[model samples]
Target: MPKSLQGLTVLVTRPAHQASRFQQLLAAEGAHAVLFPVVEICPPDDLAALTAQLVDIATYDTALFISANAVDYGLKALATPQILHHLTLGAIGKKTAQALQQHGFTAQWVPTAGFTSEDWLALPQTQQLAGRRILIFRGAGGRELLADTLRQRGATVTQVDVYQRVCPKIAVSQLKQHHEQQQLDIIAVTSSEGILNLVAMLDNPAWIKTLSLLVGSPRMRETARQAGFDGTLIMADNPSDEAMLQALIQWAQE
Candidate 1:
Protein backbone atom coordinates (compact mmCIF):
# COMPACT_ATOMS: atom_id res chain seq x y z
CA MET A 1 0.00 0.00 0.00
CA PRO A 2 3.03 2.24 0.50
CA LYS A 3 4.16 1.97 -3.13
CA SER A 4 7.42 0.48 -1.88
CA LEU A 5 8.16 -1.13 -5.21
CA GLN A 6 7.34 1.85 -7.41
CA GLY A 7 8.84 1.81 -10.87
CA LEU A 8 10.13 -1.74 -10.53
CA THR A 9 9.46 -4.37 -13.17
CA VAL A 10 9.14 -7.92 -11.86
CA LEU A 11 9.09 -11.01 -14.03
CA VAL A 12 6.82 -13.60 -12.40
CA THR A 13 7.52 -17.16 -13.58
CA ARG A 14 4.98 -19.10 -11.56
CA PRO A 15 2.16 -21.03 -13.22
CA ALA A 16 -0.64 -18.83 -14.64
CA HIS A 17 -3.20 -19.93 -12.03
CA GLN A 18 -0.91 -19.19 -9.07
CA ALA A 19 0.53 -15.93 -10.44
CA SER A 20 -2.52 -13.71 -10.05
CA ARG A 21 -2.28 -13.17 -6.27
CA PHE A 22 1.44 -12.42 -6.41
CA GLN A 23 0.82 -10.08 -9.36
CA GLN A 24 -1.78 -8.23 -7.35
CA LEU A 25 0.64 -7.95 -4.45
CA LEU A 26 3.26 -6.40 -6.69
CA ALA A 27 0.73 -4.11 -8.36
CA ALA A 28 -0.43 -2.87 -4.94
CA GLU A 29 3.09 -1.59 -4.34
CA GLY A 30 3.07 0.17 -7.74
CA ALA A 31 5.44 -2.29 -9.32
CA HIS A 32 4.93 -3.45 -12.90
CA ALA A 33 4.34 -7.21 -12.63
CA VAL A 34 5.07 -9.16 -15.83
CA LEU A 35 3.45 -12.52 -16.28
CA PHE A 36 5.75 -15.10 -17.85
CA PRO A 37 4.39 -18.42 -16.76
CA VAL A 38 7.06 -21.07 -17.13
CA VAL A 39 5.27 -24.06 -15.70
CA GLU A 40 1.86 -25.50 -16.61
CA ILE A 41 -0.02 -27.72 -14.13
CA CYS A 42 -2.00 -30.59 -15.60
CA PRO A 43 -3.65 -33.80 -14.46
CA PRO A 44 -1.49 -36.88 -14.48
CA ASP A 45 -1.55 -39.10 -17.58
CA ASP A 46 -3.17 -42.04 -15.78
CA LEU A 47 -6.13 -40.64 -13.88
CA ALA A 48 -7.62 -44.12 -13.71
CA ALA A 49 -4.64 -45.45 -11.83
CA LEU A 50 -4.70 -42.49 -9.50
CA THR A 51 -8.41 -42.91 -8.91
CA ALA A 52 -8.00 -46.64 -8.32
CA GLN A 53 -5.57 -46.02 -5.46
CA LEU A 54 -8.28 -44.15 -3.59
CA VAL A 55 -10.24 -47.42 -3.40
CA ASP A 56 -7.90 -48.47 -0.58
CA ILE A 57 -7.49 -45.03 0.94
CA ALA A 58 -8.65 -46.31 4.31
CA THR A 59 -5.79 -48.82 4.39
CA TYR A 60 -3.15 -46.12 4.80
CA ASP A 61 -2.21 -44.94 8.28
CA THR A 62 -1.26 -41.48 7.05
CA ALA A 63 -1.81 -39.19 4.07
CA LEU A 64 0.69 -36.45 3.20
CA PHE A 65 0.27 -33.71 0.59
CA ILE A 66 3.23 -31.98 -1.01
CA SER A 67 1.41 -28.91 -2.30
CA ALA A 68 -1.97 -27.25 -2.63
CA ASN A 69 -2.27 -28.59 -6.17
CA ALA A 70 -1.77 -32.07 -4.79
CA VAL A 71 -4.48 -31.52 -2.20
CA ASP A 72 -6.94 -30.30 -4.83
CA TYR A 73 -6.24 -32.85 -7.54
CA GLY A 74 -5.65 -35.74 -5.15
CA LEU A 75 -8.96 -35.22 -3.39
CA LYS A 76 -10.78 -34.95 -6.71
CA ALA A 77 -9.48 -38.37 -7.67
CA LEU A 78 -11.24 -39.95 -4.70
CA ALA A 79 -14.76 -41.33 -5.13
CA THR A 80 -15.53 -40.72 -1.47
CA PRO A 81 -13.61 -37.87 0.13
CA GLN A 82 -15.00 -38.79 3.55
CA ILE A 83 -12.91 -41.94 3.53
CA LEU A 84 -9.78 -39.84 4.20
CA HIS A 85 -11.08 -38.78 7.62
CA HIS A 86 -9.67 -41.86 9.31
CA LEU A 87 -6.07 -41.30 8.23
CA THR A 88 -3.53 -39.02 9.90
CA LEU A 89 -3.44 -36.18 7.39
CA GLY A 90 -0.22 -34.24 6.99
CA ALA A 91 0.75 -31.29 4.84
CA ILE A 92 4.18 -30.00 3.93
CA GLY A 93 3.25 -26.35 4.51
CA LYS A 94 0.55 -24.18 6.04
CA LYS A 95 -0.91 -23.50 2.59
CA THR A 96 -1.29 -27.19 1.80
CA ALA A 97 -2.86 -27.73 5.20
CA GLN A 98 -5.25 -24.87 4.55
CA ALA A 99 -6.18 -26.49 1.24
CA LEU A 100 -7.17 -29.65 3.09
CA GLN A 101 -9.19 -27.62 5.56
CA GLN A 102 -11.13 -26.08 2.68
CA HIS A 103 -12.34 -29.57 1.77
CA GLY A 104 -13.34 -30.35 5.40
CA PHE A 105 -10.20 -32.34 6.30
CA THR A 106 -7.82 -31.31 9.02
CA ALA A 107 -4.10 -31.87 8.82
CA GLN A 108 -2.76 -33.35 12.05
CA TRP A 109 0.82 -32.36 11.25
CA VAL A 110 2.17 -29.30 9.48
CA PRO A 111 5.57 -27.82 10.21
CA THR A 112 5.39 -24.45 11.92
CA ALA A 113 8.79 -23.20 10.74
CA GLY A 114 9.78 -24.69 7.38
CA PHE A 115 8.13 -26.16 4.28
CA THR A 116 10.71 -28.58 2.92
CA SER A 117 10.78 -32.34 3.26
CA GLU A 118 13.69 -32.08 5.67
CA ASP A 119 11.61 -29.87 7.92
CA TRP A 120 8.70 -32.31 7.88
CA LEU A 121 11.02 -35.27 8.49
CA ALA A 122 12.55 -33.55 11.53
CA LEU A 123 9.33 -33.97 13.46
CA PRO A 124 9.58 -36.64 16.17
CA GLN A 125 6.28 -38.13 15.06
CA THR A 126 7.70 -38.84 11.62
CA GLN A 127 11.00 -40.21 12.86
CA GLN A 128 9.49 -42.96 15.03
CA LEU A 129 7.69 -44.67 12.17
CA ALA A 130 7.82 -48.46 11.98
CA GLY A 131 5.51 -50.36 9.64
CA ARG A 132 3.35 -47.29 9.11
CA ARG A 133 1.55 -47.03 5.80
CA ILE A 134 2.12 -43.52 4.45
CA LEU A 135 0.56 -42.20 1.26
CA ILE A 136 2.11 -39.16 -0.44
CA PHE A 137 0.08 -37.16 -2.95
CA ARG A 138 2.18 -34.90 -5.14
CA GLY A 139 3.00 -33.72 -8.65
CA ALA A 140 5.04 -35.96 -10.91
CA GLY A 141 8.86 -36.00 -10.59
CA GLY A 142 9.05 -34.19 -7.26
CA ARG A 143 12.00 -34.82 -4.96
CA GLU A 144 12.07 -38.29 -3.34
CA LEU A 145 13.58 -37.10 -0.07
CA LEU A 146 10.41 -37.39 1.99
CA ALA A 147 9.41 -40.85 0.78
CA ASP A 148 12.99 -42.14 0.85
CA THR A 149 13.54 -40.94 4.41
CA LEU A 150 10.20 -42.32 5.57
CA ARG A 151 11.09 -45.65 3.99
CA GLN A 152 14.38 -45.58 5.91
CA ARG A 153 12.37 -45.07 9.08
CA GLY A 154 10.55 -48.35 8.27
CA ALA A 155 7.38 -46.82 6.84
CA THR A 156 5.76 -48.26 3.76
CA VAL A 157 5.63 -44.98 1.80
CA THR A 158 3.49 -45.10 -1.33
CA GLN A 159 3.78 -41.97 -3.51
CA VAL A 160 0.95 -41.16 -5.91
CA ASP A 161 1.23 -38.63 -8.71
CA VAL A 162 -1.81 -36.42 -8.83
CA TYR A 163 -0.53 -33.76 -11.19
CA GLN A 164 2.31 -33.11 -13.60
CA ARG A 165 4.26 -29.95 -14.39
CA VAL A 166 5.31 -29.12 -17.91
CA CYS A 167 6.94 -26.04 -19.33
CA PRO A 168 4.53 -24.04 -21.45
CA LYS A 169 5.50 -22.91 -24.91
CA ILE A 170 5.88 -19.18 -25.06
CA ALA A 171 7.83 -16.84 -27.30
CA VAL A 172 11.31 -15.92 -26.12
CA SER A 173 10.79 -12.50 -27.70
CA GLN A 174 8.35 -11.62 -24.95
CA LEU A 175 11.12 -11.57 -22.33
CA LYS A 176 13.61 -10.34 -24.85
CA GLN A 177 11.36 -7.39 -25.67
CA HIS A 178 11.18 -6.41 -22.02
CA HIS A 179 14.92 -6.80 -21.52
CA GLU A 180 15.73 -4.79 -24.61
CA GLN A 181 13.59 -1.93 -23.37
CA GLN A 182 15.51 -2.00 -20.06
CA GLN A 183 12.22 -2.62 -18.25
CA LEU A 184 13.30 -5.76 -16.38
CA ASP A 185 14.27 -5.26 -12.75
CA ILE A 186 13.85 -8.56 -10.97
CA ILE A 187 12.90 -12.11 -11.97
CA ALA A 188 11.11 -14.28 -9.40
CA VAL A 189 10.82 -18.06 -9.71
CA THR A 190 9.33 -20.45 -7.14
CA SER A 191 10.60 -23.87 -8.19
CA SER A 192 13.75 -25.49 -9.58
CA GLU A 193 11.84 -26.62 -12.65
CA GLY A 194 10.44 -23.15 -13.18
CA ILE A 195 13.89 -21.58 -13.17
CA LEU A 196 15.18 -24.13 -15.66
CA ASN A 197 12.16 -23.53 -17.89
CA LEU A 198 12.68 -19.78 -17.72
CA VAL A 199 16.22 -20.16 -18.97
CA ALA A 200 15.20 -22.62 -21.65
CA MET A 201 12.43 -20.31 -22.85
CA LEU A 202 14.90 -17.58 -23.66
CA ASP A 203 16.87 -17.68 -26.87
CA ASN A 204 19.66 -15.72 -25.21
CA PRO A 205 19.54 -15.55 -21.44
CA ALA A 206 22.81 -13.73 -20.78
CA TRP A 207 20.98 -10.53 -19.81
CA ILE A 208 18.76 -12.45 -17.39
CA LYS A 209 21.84 -13.63 -15.51
CA THR A 210 22.62 -10.04 -14.60
CA LEU A 211 19.24 -9.02 -13.22
CA SER A 212 18.19 -9.55 -9.60
CA LEU A 213 16.71 -13.03 -9.08
CA LEU A 214 14.20 -13.81 -6.33
CA VAL A 215 13.52 -17.46 -5.54
CA GLY A 216 11.26 -19.23 -3.06
CA SER A 217 13.76 -21.68 -1.54
CA PRO A 218 17.45 -22.48 -1.29
CA ARG A 219 16.87 -25.35 -3.69
CA MET A 220 15.48 -22.95 -6.27
CA ARG A 221 18.36 -20.52 -5.72
CA GLU A 222 20.85 -23.33 -6.18
CA THR A 223 19.07 -24.36 -9.35
CA ALA A 224 19.36 -20.79 -10.69
CA ARG A 225 23.08 -20.81 -9.95
CA GLN A 226 23.42 -24.15 -11.72
CA ALA A 227 21.66 -22.69 -14.75
CA GLY A 228 24.29 -19.91 -14.95
CA PHE A 229 22.24 -17.16 -13.42
CA ASP A 230 24.90 -15.06 -11.61
CA GLY A 231 22.54 -12.28 -10.60
CA THR A 232 21.82 -11.11 -7.06
CA LEU A 233 19.97 -14.09 -5.63
CA ILE A 234 17.19 -13.24 -3.15
CA MET A 235 15.71 -16.12 -1.18
CA ALA A 236 12.19 -15.95 0.21
CA ASP A 237 11.62 -17.48 3.64
CA ASN A 238 8.93 -19.65 2.10
CA PRO A 239 7.15 -20.23 -1.19
CA SER A 240 3.93 -18.58 -0.04
CA ASP A 241 2.76 -15.57 -2.03
CA GLU A 242 2.85 -13.39 1.09
CA ALA A 243 6.42 -14.42 1.91
CA MET A 244 7.52 -13.88 -1.68
CA LEU A 245 6.03 -10.38 -1.67
CA GLN A 246 7.71 -9.59 1.64
CA ALA A 247 11.05 -10.74 0.25
CA LEU A 248 10.55 -8.57 -2.83
CA ILE A 249 9.64 -5.53 -0.75
CA GLN A 250 12.62 -6.08 1.52
CA TRP A 251 14.98 -6.29 -1.45
CA ALA A 252 13.47 -3.12 -2.94
CA GLN A 253 13.96 -1.26 0.34
CA GLU A 254 17.58 -2.41 0.53
Candidate 2:
Protein backbone atom coordinates (compact mmCIF):
# COMPACT_ATOMS: atom_id res chain seq x y z
CA MET A 1 0.00 0.00 0.00
CA PRO A 2 3.04 2.28 0.37
CA LYS A 3 4.35 4.39 -2.49
CA SER A 4 7.88 3.42 -1.48
CA LEU A 5 9.40 0.04 -2.27
CA GLN A 6 7.49 -2.48 -0.18
CA GLY A 7 7.85 -6.14 -1.10
CA LEU A 8 10.77 -5.99 -3.52
CA THR A 9 14.17 -7.42 -2.70
CA VAL A 10 17.17 -5.41 -3.89
CA LEU A 11 20.80 -6.42 -3.93
CA VAL A 12 23.69 -4.06 -3.22
CA THR A 13 27.08 -4.77 -4.80
CA ARG A 14 29.19 -2.02 -3.29
CA PRO A 15 32.03 -2.69 -0.85
CA ALA A 16 31.10 -3.62 2.73
CA HIS A 17 31.57 -0.21 4.32
CA GLN A 18 30.00 1.61 1.36
CA ALA A 19 27.05 -0.77 1.14
CA SER A 20 25.64 -0.17 4.62
CA ARG A 21 24.27 3.34 4.07
CA PHE A 22 22.64 2.38 0.77
CA GLN A 23 21.17 -0.69 2.46
CA GLN A 24 19.73 1.44 5.25
CA LEU A 25 18.19 3.82 2.73
CA LEU A 26 16.60 0.95 0.81
CA ALA A 27 15.30 -0.59 4.03
CA ALA A 28 13.75 2.77 4.92
CA GLU A 29 11.89 2.54 1.59
CA GLY A 30 10.67 -0.90 2.65
CA ALA A 31 12.71 -3.00 0.21
CA HIS A 32 14.66 -5.99 1.44
CA ALA A 33 18.33 -5.15 0.89
CA VAL A 34 20.91 -7.81 0.18
CA LEU A 35 24.65 -7.29 -0.11
CA PHE A 36 26.74 -9.19 -2.65
CA PRO A 37 30.07 -7.47 -2.86
CA VAL A 38 31.50 -8.35 -6.24
CA VAL A 39 34.86 -6.79 -5.64
CA GLU A 40 37.08 -6.52 -2.58
CA ILE A 41 39.51 -3.62 -2.19
CA CYS A 42 43.12 -4.43 -1.38
CA PRO A 43 46.39 -2.54 -1.44
CA PRO A 44 48.57 -3.10 -4.43
CA ASP A 45 51.45 -5.54 -3.97
CA ASP A 46 54.09 -3.29 -5.51
CA LEU A 47 54.36 0.20 -4.16
CA ALA A 48 57.83 0.69 -5.58
CA ALA A 49 56.50 2.05 -8.85
CA LEU A 50 54.05 4.29 -7.02
CA THR A 51 56.80 5.44 -4.67
CA ALA A 52 59.03 6.41 -7.56
CA GLN A 53 56.20 8.32 -9.20
CA LEU A 54 55.51 10.26 -6.01
CA VAL A 55 59.12 11.37 -5.81
CA ASP A 56 58.40 13.77 -8.68
CA ILE A 57 54.89 14.67 -7.62
CA ALA A 58 55.71 18.34 -7.57
CA THR A 59 56.74 18.18 -11.20
CA TYR A 60 53.30 17.08 -12.36
CA ASP A 61 50.93 19.90 -13.28
CA THR A 62 47.81 17.90 -12.48
CA ALA A 63 46.73 14.76 -10.63
CA LEU A 64 43.56 12.77 -11.22
CA PHE A 65 41.59 10.24 -9.20
CA ILE A 66 39.19 7.97 -11.07
CA SER A 67 37.18 6.72 -8.11
CA ALA A 68 36.62 7.17 -4.38
CA ASN A 69 38.63 4.01 -3.80
CA ALA A 70 41.55 5.69 -5.48
CA VAL A 71 41.32 8.56 -3.01
CA ASP A 72 41.17 6.11 -0.09
CA TYR A 73 44.05 3.81 -1.08
CA GLY A 74 46.13 6.36 -2.95
CA LEU A 75 46.20 8.85 -0.07
CA LYS A 76 47.19 6.12 2.36
CA ALA A 77 50.33 5.36 0.31
CA LEU A 78 51.65 8.89 0.71
CA ALA A 79 53.70 8.91 3.89
CA THR A 80 54.31 12.64 4.11
CA PRO A 81 52.42 15.93 3.94
CA GLN A 82 54.78 17.55 1.44
CA ILE A 83 53.76 15.19 -1.39
CA LEU A 84 50.09 15.99 -0.81
CA HIS A 85 50.59 19.71 -1.36
CA HIS A 86 52.54 19.55 -4.58
CA LEU A 87 50.10 19.25 -7.49
CA THR A 88 46.59 20.42 -8.44
CA LEU A 89 44.17 17.59 -7.89
CA GLY A 90 41.29 16.55 -10.18
CA ALA A 91 38.46 14.13 -9.50
CA ILE A 92 36.01 12.36 -11.78
CA GLY A 93 33.03 13.15 -9.56
CA LYS A 94 31.85 14.92 -6.42
CA LYS A 95 32.09 11.77 -4.32
CA THR A 96 35.70 11.13 -5.29
CA ALA A 97 36.52 14.79 -4.74
CA GLN A 98 34.85 14.71 -1.33
CA ALA A 99 36.95 11.74 -0.33
CA LEU A 100 40.07 13.62 -1.34
CA GLN A 101 38.94 16.69 0.62
CA GLN A 102 38.31 14.53 3.68
CA HIS A 103 41.92 13.38 3.49
CA GLY A 104 43.13 17.03 3.45
CA PHE A 105 43.54 17.36 -0.31
CA THR A 106 41.46 19.90 -2.15
CA ALA A 107 40.51 19.14 -5.74
CA GLN A 108 40.89 22.06 -8.11
CA TRP A 109 38.88 20.38 -10.86
CA VAL A 110 35.96 18.02 -11.10
CA PRO A 111 33.57 16.84 -13.82
CA THR A 112 30.80 19.36 -14.43
CA ALA A 113 27.91 16.91 -14.12
CA GLY A 114 28.44 13.36 -15.34
CA PHE A 115 30.94 11.10 -13.55
CA THR A 116 32.83 9.63 -16.50
CA SER A 117 36.08 10.05 -18.38
CA GLU A 118 34.31 11.70 -21.29
CA ASP A 119 32.81 14.29 -18.95
CA TRP A 120 36.15 14.96 -17.27
CA LEU A 121 37.88 15.32 -20.61
CA ALA A 122 35.46 18.07 -21.57
CA LEU A 123 36.54 20.24 -18.63
CA PRO A 124 38.53 23.37 -19.59
CA GLN A 125 41.47 22.21 -17.48
CA THR A 126 41.74 19.02 -19.51
CA GLN A 127 41.85 20.93 -22.79
CA GLN A 128 45.51 21.93 -22.55
CA LEU A 129 47.25 18.83 -21.29
CA ALA A 130 50.10 19.65 -23.65
CA GLY A 131 53.44 20.05 -21.90
CA ARG A 132 51.84 19.20 -18.58
CA ARG A 133 52.81 16.16 -16.58
CA ILE A 134 49.81 14.37 -15.12
CA LEU A 135 49.48 11.64 -12.54
CA ILE A 136 46.41 9.41 -12.31
CA PHE A 137 45.77 7.27 -9.26
CA ARG A 138 43.18 4.56 -9.59
CA GLY A 139 42.26 0.90 -9.15
CA ALA A 140 43.82 -1.73 -11.38
CA GLY A 141 42.27 -2.10 -14.87
CA GLY A 142 39.92 0.73 -15.90
CA ARG A 143 39.11 2.93 -18.86
CA GLU A 144 42.21 4.36 -20.53
CA LEU A 145 40.27 7.04 -22.42
CA LEU A 146 41.45 9.85 -20.16
CA ALA A 147 45.08 8.74 -20.23
CA ASP A 148 45.06 8.18 -23.97
CA THR A 149 43.41 11.52 -24.64
CA LEU A 150 45.87 13.30 -22.37
CA ARG A 151 48.76 11.65 -24.18
CA GLN A 152 47.28 12.80 -27.49
CA ARG A 153 47.31 16.34 -26.14
CA GLY A 154 51.05 15.91 -25.48
CA ALA A 155 50.78 15.49 -21.71
CA THR A 156 53.22 13.17 -19.99
CA VAL A 157 50.89 10.80 -18.14
CA THR A 158 51.86 8.54 -15.28
CA GLN A 159 49.34 6.07 -13.95
CA VAL A 160 49.66 4.63 -10.47
CA ASP A 161 47.56 1.60 -9.71
CA VAL A 162 47.24 2.16 -5.99
CA TYR A 163 44.58 -0.42 -5.30
CA GLN A 164 43.46 -3.71 -6.75
CA ARG A 165 39.82 -4.84 -7.03
CA VAL A 166 39.27 -8.54 -7.33
CA CYS A 167 36.20 -10.71 -7.10
CA PRO A 168 36.18 -12.73 -3.90
CA LYS A 169 37.08 -16.26 -4.91
CA ILE A 170 35.11 -17.66 -1.98
CA ALA A 171 31.93 -15.86 -3.00
CA VAL A 172 31.50 -18.06 -6.05
CA SER A 173 30.19 -21.04 -4.10
CA GLN A 174 28.07 -18.90 -1.82
CA LEU A 175 26.52 -17.04 -4.75
CA LYS A 176 25.86 -20.26 -6.60
CA GLN A 177 24.08 -21.72 -3.62
CA HIS A 178 22.03 -18.58 -3.21
CA HIS A 179 21.10 -18.53 -6.85
CA GLU A 180 19.98 -22.15 -6.70
CA GLN A 181 17.77 -21.27 -3.78
CA GLN A 182 16.40 -18.17 -5.56
CA GLN A 183 17.37 -16.02 -2.62
CA LEU A 184 18.55 -13.12 -4.77
CA ASP A 185 15.91 -10.90 -6.39
CA ILE A 186 17.70 -7.87 -7.76
CA ILE A 187 21.51 -7.74 -8.16
CA ALA A 188 23.18 -4.37 -8.18
CA VAL A 189 26.34 -3.75 -10.19
CA THR A 190 28.16 -0.44 -9.87
CA SER A 191 30.87 -1.19 -12.40
CA SER A 192 31.13 -3.06 -15.66
CA GLU A 193 33.79 -5.23 -14.09
CA GLY A 194 31.40 -6.27 -11.35
CA ILE A 195 28.85 -7.36 -13.95
CA LEU A 196 31.46 -9.38 -15.81
CA ASN A 197 32.58 -11.04 -12.58
CA LEU A 198 28.99 -11.97 -11.73
CA VAL A 199 28.46 -13.49 -15.16
CA ALA A 200 31.74 -15.36 -14.92
CA MET A 201 30.75 -16.87 -11.61
CA LEU A 202 27.36 -17.97 -12.82
CA ASP A 203 28.10 -19.50 -16.22
CA ASN A 204 24.67 -21.04 -16.36
CA PRO A 205 22.49 -19.03 -18.68
CA ALA A 206 19.27 -20.05 -17.03
CA TRP A 207 20.36 -18.91 -13.60
CA ILE A 208 21.61 -15.54 -14.82
CA LYS A 209 18.38 -15.05 -16.75
CA THR A 210 16.33 -15.04 -13.57
CA LEU A 211 18.19 -12.18 -11.90
CA SER A 212 17.31 -8.51 -12.30
CA LEU A 213 20.26 -6.11 -12.52
CA LEU A 214 20.59 -2.55 -11.30
CA VAL A 215 23.61 -0.67 -12.67
CA GLY A 216 25.08 2.55 -11.28
CA SER A 217 25.72 4.34 -14.59
CA PRO A 218 25.06 4.26 -18.31
CA ARG A 219 28.56 2.93 -18.89
CA MET A 220 27.72 -0.11 -16.79
CA ARG A 221 24.34 -0.42 -18.51
CA GLU A 222 26.12 -0.72 -21.86
CA THR A 223 28.33 -3.41 -20.38
CA ALA A 224 25.35 -5.41 -19.18
CA ARG A 225 23.66 -5.15 -22.59
CA GLN A 226 26.84 -6.28 -24.29
CA ALA A 227 27.12 -9.21 -21.92
CA GLY A 228 23.76 -10.57 -23.17
CA PHE A 229 21.62 -9.21 -20.36
CA ASP A 230 18.35 -8.68 -22.25
CA GLY A 231 16.29 -7.99 -19.16
CA THR A 232 15.67 -4.60 -17.66
CA LEU A 233 18.89 -2.77 -16.71
CA ILE A 234 18.18 0.07 -14.32
CA MET A 235 20.64 2.92 -14.08
CA ALA A 236 21.62 5.21 -11.23
CA ASP A 237 22.55 8.72 -12.39
CA ASN A 238 25.70 8.53 -10.31
CA PRO A 239 27.57 6.19 -7.98
CA SER A 240 26.70 8.02 -4.79
CA ASP A 241 24.69 6.08 -2.19
CA GLU A 242 21.76 8.46 -2.51
CA ALA A 243 21.59 7.99 -6.28
CA MET A 244 21.82 4.23 -5.94
CA LEU A 245 19.17 4.08 -3.23
CA GLN A 246 16.82 6.26 -5.26
CA ALA A 247 17.22 4.05 -8.31
CA LEU A 248 16.62 0.93 -6.20
CA ILE A 249 13.48 2.43 -4.70
CA GLN A 250 12.14 3.31 -8.14
CA TRP A 251 12.90 -0.15 -9.45
CA ALA A 252 11.19 -1.79 -6.47
CA GLN A 253 8.11 0.35 -6.93
CA GLU A 254 7.79 -0.80 -10.54
For TM-score, the strongest prediction is 1
34-78 per-residue lDDT for model 2 (tens digits): 677777888888878777767767777788999889988888787
Which one is best on lDDT? 1
TM-score of model 1 (CA atoms): 0.96
Scored against the true structure, residue 213 in model 1 reaches a CA lDDT of: 94
TM-scores for candidates 1 onward, in order: 0.96, 0.91
How many Å off is the CA of 235 in candidate 2?
Answer: 1.9
Question: Against the correct fold, how does model 2 do in TM-score?
Answer: 0.91
lDDT for 252 in candidate 1 is 91
Deviation in Å, model 2, residue 120 alpha carbon: 0.7
Q: In angstroms, give how far residue 128 of model 2 lies from its true place.
A: 1.6
Give candidate 1's root-mean-square deviation (CA, Å): 1.4
